[model samples]
Target: MKELINKYYQNHSLIYKVLLFLITTAVIVYFFPKGGKFKYNLQKGKPWQYENLYAPFDFSIQKSPEELNAEKEEIEKSKQLFFLVKEEVKAEVIESYNKKVDFILKDSLALKMNKARLKNFGEKFINNVYKVGFLNKADNSKIQSNQLITLRLGNEASDILSDNLFTTDELVSSIQQYFTNSSYESLENNFTSLFFEILEPNVFYDEELTNRALEEELKNRSFTKGFVAENERIISKGDMVDASKYEILDSLKKEYDTQLWSKSSYNWIVVGYTILVALVLVMLFLFLKKYRLEIFHNNTKLTFILFNIVLFVFLVTIVQKYFVGYLYVVPIIILPIVLKAFFDARLGLFTHVLTVLLLGFIVPNSFEFVFLQIIAGMVTILTVSELHRRANLFVSILKITLIYTVAYLAFSIIQNGSEQKIQWVYFGMFALNGVLSFLSLFLILIYEKSFGLVSDVSLLELSDTNSTLLRELNEKAPGTFQHSMQVANLAEASANEIGANAMLVRAGALYHDIGKMLNPMYFTENQTTSVSPHHDLSPTDSAKIIRDHVIKGIEMAKKNGLPDRLIDFIRTHHGTNTIYYFYKMQSELTPDQVNIEDFKYPGPIPFSKETAILMMCDSCEAASKSLKTPTALLIDELVEKVINTQMSQGQFMNSDITFKEIQTIKKVIKKKLHNIYHLRIEYPE
Candidate 1:
């Protein structure tokens, strides 16, 4: 039982990996739509490639969105506007007019006119004008075409031509003619102004009632004008899918997705989703295990990758359910951009394609959506390869947006065969997608902070010599600072030649020797006077101090908050190789008492191509400074000896760097050294 527990304890990490894989698969599967996928790839312009297609169940043929929108637009144009006539307003106006006339006659200069006849004619005119109804000015501007409005007077309603109604202007004309035929032309102008001021539009636009009636009409609007019985042949093989046939196929697909499945079939559907989603995630895991073993072994990085996929799938799935129109605007392109920033383009594009394929099942028009997104993902990977460069960052974003828009445009035109028929809203979606893709920059910063991982952007920031830690290193140990800079250049060039992360290696190289600052004078490079610190110390003490630099560097780096990745270079730059000078001297004096382990630098060795390159560059750069009169040949020999010695000592055994890559790095170092020494090529005749 004890042995069994120990065995389980030893394999806990592997078990954790298995659990992570299962959880990722389950989460992705849960994001899938709980419906069966339609079996056919339906395209409107393409010929039917399958055998005679038939409806398996009875379903109404749904009208196309364009058709439904056209119907609604007709209703908007031809709907009747209802107006109510207030019968009480007529009586109110007459009483108010009589009061005004009585008061005006007592003070008027024209009191010789028959006041009773004047009041009677004005009352008669008001009844004639307010008979039909007058429209308010606000509603008049809405309808420019011929309008037939419904006028309601209490419980009675009647349809009347809008031209028959009297506007305020028409009332003026009628009043002029009435007075021309009467004996009251003396007060015509004054009464005309009074009539205009006293009268209000009795027949108002019944906006509330009109809207309710419109809603009732719209609610009764039929989405389907026809229905197809079960087993009806929809289309035959090799038949062109015209508009009518396309509508039938689309309607059938919608029914297939929405119709309730039987208990057994639903369970089967869920099982199918599980198997497919699990397979995709399995492929991702296998890819990481095979190609990116370092990341596969590190659970933090593995979780980071998995978390990104799940987060995007969740966001896109929610959008698919709630805001279906904004599906394209969900910014799926950001997946590739973020992955490329943290990892490599190849992995980014691969995982992006996988993620888009998973989403293909959720979004409608799966083929077109998957095709467009895969292309966009590839474009993202290609352009965002150098996201650390601020100039190239916007350029990449613009290129990604342009590619997505142009591709979507071309696909739309090809599918519809008419640019006018293309749904222009998708163009806005694509533009907004581009805008949202810029969020990848902020997302990267968030991931860095959350996951304790580093990206090229962070590496670039750390690479700046003016940073606090680097500035202190320069002030305290200028010689070590200069050495680190030279080593950084060499490591960067070597990394570029071997297709490693140049920025990462450069950052690693810069902070690798920070421990030398603690005891700067002990190192030969910082010794300005003719005296040496090691002269007063014994060989054992000297070796101990020299080896303590790696330990001290790691402590200082952790204290200052450097990433574990950069700290690795400080730990492994010298590997476990011995400080041979002090070791040899100690052994010569006390062969029996000298301990080899005490002389060795504590190291786990360089465990990656970047760290291995730093080790080689560090050793070669320091050794190069010792040459009294250097030549290209001697520099070449020095690089070969240093790297080969480290190689024979198994320093690069765990680094995963190949022999060819090592040879290439050596050649780069030799050439760079020759240039630094100003060695000109011997061009002989």
Candidate 2:
């Protein structure tokens, strides 16, 4: 039992990878929307390719959107709008008119005789205006004269022509017209002024009541106009889906998707979703395991990849639930852009395609959505080669947006066949998706800090020679700084030749010997004087100082907050090779007292191509500087000897560098060194 536990602990990494995939699969399944899918792909104007379709049960035929919209428009155009009558305003006007009418009339012997007639006329005119209903003149333009509006007075409501209502201006005109035909033309001004002063609008448009009435009317509108009985054949195979056939099939599909099934059936649906989602995740696992074993071995990176997939899936699910019209606005292309930034284009595109395939089950128009996202993802991987340049990302976004718009447009044209039926709103959605894709830059920064991973953009920033750490190295150890620069150039060139990470290797090379800054004169390159500090110290002490620089470098790098990837160079540049010169001196002086481990570097060795290249370049570049006079043949011999010695000592045993790549690197280093020394080819004399 103890041995079994130990065995489990021993293979924990492999076990963790298995659990990682399983957990991710389960999480994705949880995010999968619950529902049954209609087993047919519906496309208007396409032939029914399946067997004769029959209604499983009696279901209503849902009206098409166009049909429902037409009904709504007709109702909106003819609906009776409500206007609430202000009975209080009418009473106030009547009461104030009686009080103010005397002000308009003066006592005259002839006027007194007609005073009763004038008072009666004034009361009748006021009553007539209010009875006809006074409305604001500004509202007249919104409703047509013949349009019907319901006038609600107290508890009673009556529909009337909008033209029947009197405006304040019309009331004045009517008073003047009445005076012109009668004998009291001189009293026109007085009557007009008095009535106008006392009159107030007593009717207003009741938008709330109008909306309630409209809703009541709409309640009578039926969503379905017809019903198909059970066992009725909806369409025959190979029949072109005409308008009538399309509606029945669409209605059946809606009913089928929304219909509740038994628990056993729902569980089977869950099982189906699980199997499909698991299959996709397994394919992704196999891809990583076969083609990207390094990333596959790293649980953090694999989890990052899986997290992105699930994150986008959740985003798509939410959008589909609430904002289905803007489903394309989710920035599906961000997956490939982010993956390509941290990894490579092939892996980015592969993972993106699989993710999009998973989303097919959730988004509408599955084929079109998958095609558009897959194409856009491919364009993202192809166009955005360098995340270090912000301009490149912008340009890639534009290209991706263009691809999305063009692909979606083509699909629309193919399905609808006419440009008139195309939904142009999707173009705006594609543009929004592109804009959101820029969020990947911000997300990349977050991922770097959160996951402790590195990207090309970060590597590029570190490669700047004027950065804080590199600047400090230059000030304290100028020779070592210059040496690091040469090694950076050599490592970068070799990495480019072997398809390795050029930026990463260059950044690592610049900071590899930063610990030499502490004791600048102890290193031969940093020493300016002819006398050596080592001459005054014992060989054991000197060798100890040399071996301690690696440890010191790691400490300084961490204090400066450099990425762990670059710190690997500091740890493995010398690998575990012995400080042979000082060791030999110590052995000769006190052969009985020497311990071999004290003179060796504490190393984990190079574990990748970039680190292996740095190991080779650092040793070859530093060794080449020691030659009194460098020739083409001498440089070649030094390069071969340095790299061959590292190879024999098993420094590169953990790294994946090939023997051919090493030979190529040796040639590149020899050429770079020769150029540094300005060596010329010798002619046969």
Candidate 3:
């Protein structure tokens, strides 16, 4: 299984690329919402751009959420509540009242007649109370109107009661009237006092029945305000889309969108989507191939770039399905920021544009969406060019957010001719997007570690001399470390002149000679005294020791988890060139035949301008130190000799460095070296 996996990854052939393309296409298509997109883009309050729009079929104009909510509020405010009369509750109250009357009769012997008389009075009092009806405090508050409400006693019988039916004043008055007709008028006050304690609401609000009725009524309320018949001209071109016109146009758009998926064939939609995605991907690949061929050839880099694009596009699509209004919160500018951090600005902008174009299909108002994203992407590329500094990212995100808001506001005004139509939440989302874009700083580090990729931020960290490896290099081989620093300066200058990656070359030059730390004294730079270690070894052995540093450097770099890009500097600095000193010594001793392979440094020559420039810098710097009484002329001679020798040996043939760039590099080296080795004259006093 391991071998199969290895074989699968070992060859990046046409089959592999085809498989990648197919899988990418499948993943993207799976995330897409199941619907056909409306062809014409329209917005509320905007002037119509296309010709006259007509309804293709009879469709209802659906109410907006705001309108539906308003209708619901009205229903809640005016809807009547039902109350069910519990006859058993009246019976329970009357039994309790009779028991209370018995207690009262026991206490008031002077005024009471027989128990039957008191019980009859209590029953009469309870009957009068039930006639008025009872409602809870909450239900009583809901009836604002003074009109009567109906109370249902049974399926066939009911009564209408005033809104003030259950007031305390009415309860006492009814009790007084019941006793006033009796002989126990004196007992009326005592009985009325007893009735207050036992009184409870028999008319309970039937919430379930009331809610059921309300729902039925709400269902009768039409969700559609009106209808447009088939072949009706909705709006003409150049017509201002007012609220009513916008509503009709919006209704037509929604109906057309729905019918596009349901009534029309979806097979063609799938085909169209597939073709569009393929074309965009193909364009991205071709752009990389023509301009950034190195990234194109590198499968990891290409996958990283494509993965970011697809991931963001998928996220945008999902957000469109749910939070369509806050689409600006997706932070599409993160694509350009991440790409520009890892790669160049040109590739970043191109990838961003293609990603935006794909998203345009899924979003409403394609022109505005595409316009804002493209402009924000441009701002990201131009402002966030250097992501090493935290301040740069902050400033860049602020500018990107400002551009998004301004562009969106401008589009909103063009549509509505007023700022009131703008959605403030979208502006807040743009600000949140700026804050969220800061996450890419950490994401940059994650991608660097995951994909074996490097960014300027990582390069800046690696350039610190206090790092463990660099400090170790200083402790073991201070002279060699100093030489590496000098080479780094030269290489960075030359790279900048030639438009190569200056940061990468600078980092590479610093760690290029780390292998020499393994045996510092053997190298001449770290030798403290006149006594040389090479004296004890033969010329072939000494050359072998020198050549092994490159191999050792690579091994140590791997052990320490250094990236391959930096290791390339260690591998190619010597460019298979001979170690001339030891080789000449061996030739003088033998004078016969010596194998060239033993004398040459193991190398797969420099393949980039940075590495090639480092090679020249390393050779010229090291050789220039050997010149006694160095003059400007001598430094110039040395620079030309070293670079010209490397060029003649075809060390730079594999690199993309042009002859003109090489000339520029040579001139830079001469000037820098002359400044370092300028002739000084002693003055006599």
Tell me which residue pairs clash in candidate 2: none
What value of lDDT does candidate 3 attain over all alpha carbons?
0.84
Which digits, one per residue and each the tens of the lDDT, describe model 1 over residues 542-639? 99888999999999999999988898899999999989999999999999999999899999899889999999999999999989988988999999
TM-score of model number 3: 0.77
Candidate 2 residue-wise lDDT, 171-221, digit = tens: 877787667876566677777878778888888888898888788888889
Q: Please give the range of 10 consecutive residues that has the lowest summed lDDT in model 2.
A: 104-113
Model 3, 248-312: lDDT tens per residue?
77777788888887876777777888888899999988887776776777878888988997899
Winner by TM-score: 1
Per-structure clash totals for the candidates: 0, 0, 0
TM-score for all models, in order of appearance? 0.82, 0.77, 0.77
- Rank all candidate structures by their TM-score, best first, as comma-separated numbers: 1, 3, 2
Candidate 1 clashing pairs? none
Off by over 4 Å in 1: 1-9, 47-51, 93-131, 134-146, 175-201, 237-244, 260-268, 385-388, 464-482, 514-556, 571-607, 622-629, 638-663, 679-685
